[model samples]
Target: MTDGNPDSDGLVVAAFGNRGRLETAEGETLPYLLKGRRLKAVCGDRVQWKQPPQSHEALITDILSRENALQRFDPKGRVEIIAANLTQLMVVLAPTPEPDLFLADRFLCAATLMDCNPVVVCNKTDLQHNDALRAALDEYRQLGYVVVQTCAEPGGNVADLTSLLTGHTSMLVGQSGVGKSSLINALVGDAAAAVGALSDASAEGKHTTSATIMHRLADGTRLIDSPGVREFVPNISASSEVQLGFPEIVALADRCRFANCQHLREPDCAVKQATADGDLSPRRYASYKRMKNITASGSV
Candidate 1:
């Protein structure tokens, strides 16, 4: 019931509360338990672990350094790390769920701030589409973001998504009911069953609903499926850095009259002028302002 070696390096493939699963360097997946309360491991984290005597589970001893992590502020203002070492963040949208453009904007902003490539995924393409939604999607495309239309049903355009996910550690994030689960199923068949098996093996079946699970594809792509959230506030350390998340704003910031323009009520602010002159999307500008405000307030 114990691994022979005293220590081994592994990748965290699933996280449910303080218990989860890890994949060994040799590609064996096993249930993992945290050694202490201080070490928190999320999906995509590289960790050091070992089997404890008389226990079937591996004990996670230390979490290795992460290149980057996707984070958000919890309701109580605590930083919650969603996943780590991600190369791409897919912000999924759909015809249904009313398409919260502001939420998508926030996700894209967070992806940019986390140093991950942000991909805009328009799921449920088989459903009806409206002009407003099309217009919003067009705005994102015009802003230099890669937007891919997808459908999770049979014969859906999942190949396009699969091609993008190849050779990268990508995470799908979006509002609840945006078909994130469906996309995962389409991309990786039997993903739900695999998750269930891992949960059962780990003896943590109840935590699967909120657990973040990573799926490995044939082409060396690792996809992390995160729990859908009704609302997500990215953890922004400073108000000024919020603009860095918006590429269009960053492009126009240099033209502002003041060197440190916050782009709110500032004289001759290029960003504001762009929004006024229809050069920038008004909704996106509004989102930036709101996020900046939230960051400044020090509370979500």
Candidate 2:
């Protein structure tokens, strides 16, 4: 176990802690213990630590500087940091529980707002055929976003995913049972995350990832596997911001009826005209409307 002192010189973080072996840097697992009240350290936080005179375990001292962090309302409605210094967000989804487009869009929108590159990953490709899924993925690719497909069972197509993640600090996020654990295991080259089965009756996943963890890959890549978010309610996006999330929507918003027209209910709304002309997907329009109303309600 570790003891935090003012003289320590290493970072403090726990991955799969069990009062015993915990994953650390360079594939080194160590023993750790929580310190004082103000010493709250989550995954991906850099800290200072030092080993005792006669002991093998090291004690953490101070947390170093963080580039940027992602905050969200916890279950108690209190703000909490999910991950720190994430350069990218990997939004994973599978077809078993069905791909929730709304969830994916919200995650992608948040990542864009935070200046983090968002990569869409669809796992469990071996279970289903790819005609419709490929079509959906094509739209994102056309938008200039990188999308990858993986199977994660024995041998899957994770090479594309790994290539994108190399040498960058990224966070893997999605709903449970989307093969997130499987993908993490593949990326890190081990069973770093625990895999759980989806509920047979409800087709929903049993949550396996209990906390956020930073895993370093062989190619010097760093990734944070956060707890699977079942429901992603994108916070802090205004009407204009929502439009900005959909690049195509913003591209055609200037020709709308009014400069301030939300493109929902306006006399000469260009967005509405385009939708009528079938230039935009009805489903995407519907998603925008939902976000617009949610923002207008003043409740993120």
Candidate 3:
């Protein structure tokens, strides 16, 4: 989106086909459009663009190769990139709407599959902690997941969570009403993000963030706030690759009798044996099997 250079570098801040916004090296944001069908730019993509000879909008010439990407499958069974080149993923949860431990596990598994650092953010510390919520959080902490307690209200603050995003390009993802937008506002010290509350009747979070957008902290850290979803399925390729996402399963996978064991119904499967021996969390194993089933029905 920059001037003069035929191939200028820019960071894709927001992309919505046909029109996208890019931030140039000098911190200037310019709107541009894709030049061809080769590059499907998404949030957090570093791209190259140039001004067309007789056009006002810059042309996106290229999308650089990404180190990693967080992706999901759409309803049509198409793989979609949610965000790219993220260093960390924060799974936000709250008590009012009741945290879904299975959903949390899915996000954690997605993080592992994407090779990104995962953090569990328990928001709304101001509210009375639900026993079930605390117990679930305890399970995450036991599995070596970094957990942070944060609140984005008057007495409830955001400093603890802000420190985690200091130097990394992080994505904040969770269901609505979990205070993800509120936490983003608090961490970035702004009120631009839309905030929504749970339905009084249903206690379910209202959809707030309609699009994926990026924000920057004062310390040069980039944060992306994504739309809340009721469900999330990573765009993983194979059932065997799913086991690699679970550390406990991977630790025992080599011990299985057969090298190509799926572990669900295979002989001498160490993964299933670990669950029976009480070495692995039954819930995590269950979540693993559920994902295996989900991915098995889709494309490999």
Q: How well does each candidate superpose onto the true structure, as a TM-score?
A: 0.92, 0.78, 0.89
Clashes of 3: 0
Clash number for every model?
0, 4, 0
Look at candidate 3 and tell me the lDDT of residue 44. Answer: 94
* Candidate 1 TM-score over all chains jointly: 0.92
**lDDT (0-100) at residue 147 of candidate 2?**
90
Cα displacement (Å) at residue 251, model 3:
2.2
- Stretches of candidate 3 off by over 4 Å are 1-4, 53-56, 191-207
Best model per lDDT: 1
**Angstrom error at residue 161, model 2:** 0.7
lDDT of each structure? Answer: 0.86, 0.69, 0.82
Look at candidate 2 and tell me the lDDT of residue 202: 37
List per-candidate RMSD values in Å: 3.8, 4.8, 3.8
lDDT of 1 by residue, 1-300 (tens): 155565899999988778999999988899999988999999999999987779999999999999999998888888899899999999999988888887888899899998999999999999998988899999899889999999999888898898899889999998766777678878887576774454322254333335678988766579887777777888888888999989899999999999999999999999999999999988899999888887776554
The digit string of per-residue lDDT tens for model 3 on 206-271 reads 356777777777767888888778888778887778887677788888999999988899989998
lDDT of 2 by residue, 209-251 (tens): 6667666777667777766776665555356777867766888
